[model samples]
Target: MRIGVVTFPGSLDDRDAGRAVRVAGGEAVALWHGDADLHGVDAVVLPGGFSYGDYLRCGAIARFAPVMQPLVDAARGGLPVLGICNGFQTLCESHLLPGALIRNDHRKFVCRDQRLRVESTATAWTSGYEQGQEIVVPLKNGEGGFVADQRTLDELEAEGRVVVRYLDDNPNGSYRDIAGITNARGNVVGLMPHPEHAVESLTGPTTDGLGFFTSVLEGLIRA
Candidate 1:
């Protein structure tokens, strides 16, 4: 499988995302923000970073990049897309996923290893995880609080669209402790934690995150 990792100006984790893809036994394709083409990748990842210096709002400017136009259309058509941290902000700005990420309730930047429970394994990105499985990955962000209207939140909960929920503690005051979510179609996923950072035991706190990458590959095989 070929996974395209997008790199916008100021993107810090694009390379790490690509390495994670390779570690998952998939070919990594480099995609630039200025380019509109997807390079025929089977999947796409919007990696984390302070895009456009987080001007105005995190991911607000990066969402308007040329690459995102095609990504938005492709994702709507069932192309699997994973957005991490700042990428999650971009996904929200693009309206690919519901809810918005705001400043942490504590009003400070937070960085730590966070525990998360797998809420739903129905999405392409999460099919590798068992329901209710607990895993730890790095979470770092200032505006990581996820917020949505009450009705929307209810719908998400009712439909099992909430894919992952924080365990023990809410890192950034996300609504209902939601750490990640999938689009209605289950093709797009957005989360604030850095799964790519936890893919290797030698470099990270745990290897639990490798499941996310491997799970997508398994989904592709089943397809």
Candidate 2:
């Protein structure tokens, strides 16, 4: 499988995401924000970073990039897509996913090894994790709080779209301690934690995050 990892102007983890894909035994294709072509990648990942310096909003400007148009269309067509950190913000700004990420409740940048519970394994990005399993991954963000209207939140809960929940403690004050969420179809996912950073045992806190990349590969194989 070939997975495309997009690199925006200030993307910090695009390479890490690509490495994770390769480590999971898939080919990694580099994609650019200004390009409209997806290069026929089977899946796509929007890595974390301060796109356009995070000026207008975390991902407000990025959603307007030329590449996003095709990405949005493909995601709607059931193509697997994963967005991490600022990428998650972009996904919300693009309206591909519900809810928004706001300033951390503490109004500070936080970086730590965060524990997360796998709430649902139905998504292409999380099928490798057992439901209700707890795993630790690296999380670092300034505006990582997730918020949505009561109706939307309830809808997500009712549909089992809450893919991962913060465990032990809520690091960013996300509503219902949500660390990650999936679209209704389970093809697109937006997560605040940086799973790419935890895919390698030599550098990361644990290899737990590798499950996410591997899960997508497994899903592709089954399809």
Candidate 3:
């Protein structure tokens, strides 16, 4: 399977995401932020970084990139998309996902090996994980706190759309310890942690993150 990783102006982990895709046995296609086409890839990853230097807001400027217009439309049509950290912020800013990522409640950047529990495996990016399974991955960000209205939060809970939840401590003070969420259709996912960083044990804290990439490939094959 082919997976595209988008590189925005300040995308620091785009290469890492591509490597993760290759490690998971898929072709990694490099996509640029200004490009208007998706190159016919089956799936896409918006890797983490300070897009547009995080000006205005974490993902405000990058949301307007030409690539994102097609991405948003494709995502709406059930194309699998995963947004990590700043990419999650971009998804929210683009209105592809609900909730906003605000400054950390502690007002500091956090970088650590965080434990997350797989809450729902119903999404394209999480089918390789078992429900309630705990995995450790790198989490790093300044504006990583997830915030949404109470009603929206309740709906997400009721619908089982909360994909990952922080284990042990709430690193960024995200609401209800939500580390990641999937869209209602389950094709799009957004998370504050860096799953791409944990796909290889040689370079990461664990290889647990590889499940995400593999899951997408498996989901596509099943489709």
TM-scores for all predictions: 0.99, 0.99, 0.99
lDDT of 2 by residue, 136-199 (tens): 9999999999999999999999999999999887998899999999999999999999989998
| Error in Å for residue 52 of model 2 | 0.7
Which portions of model 2 show Cα errors greater than 4 Å?
Answer: none
Query: Candidate 1's residue-wise lDDT over 79-147, tens digit each?
Result: 999999999999999999999999999999999999999999999888989999999999999999999
Clashes in each model (backbone N, CA, C under 3 Å)? 0, 0, 0
Better of 1 and 2 by lDDT: 2
Flag regions of model 1 displaced more than 4 Å: none
Per-residue lDDT of candidate 3, residues 71-176 (tens digit): 9999999999999998899999999999999999999999999999999999999999999999999999999999999999999999999999999889988999
Candidate 2 to truth, TM: 0.99
Mark the regions of model 3 whose C-alpha exceeds 4 Å error after superposition. Answer: none
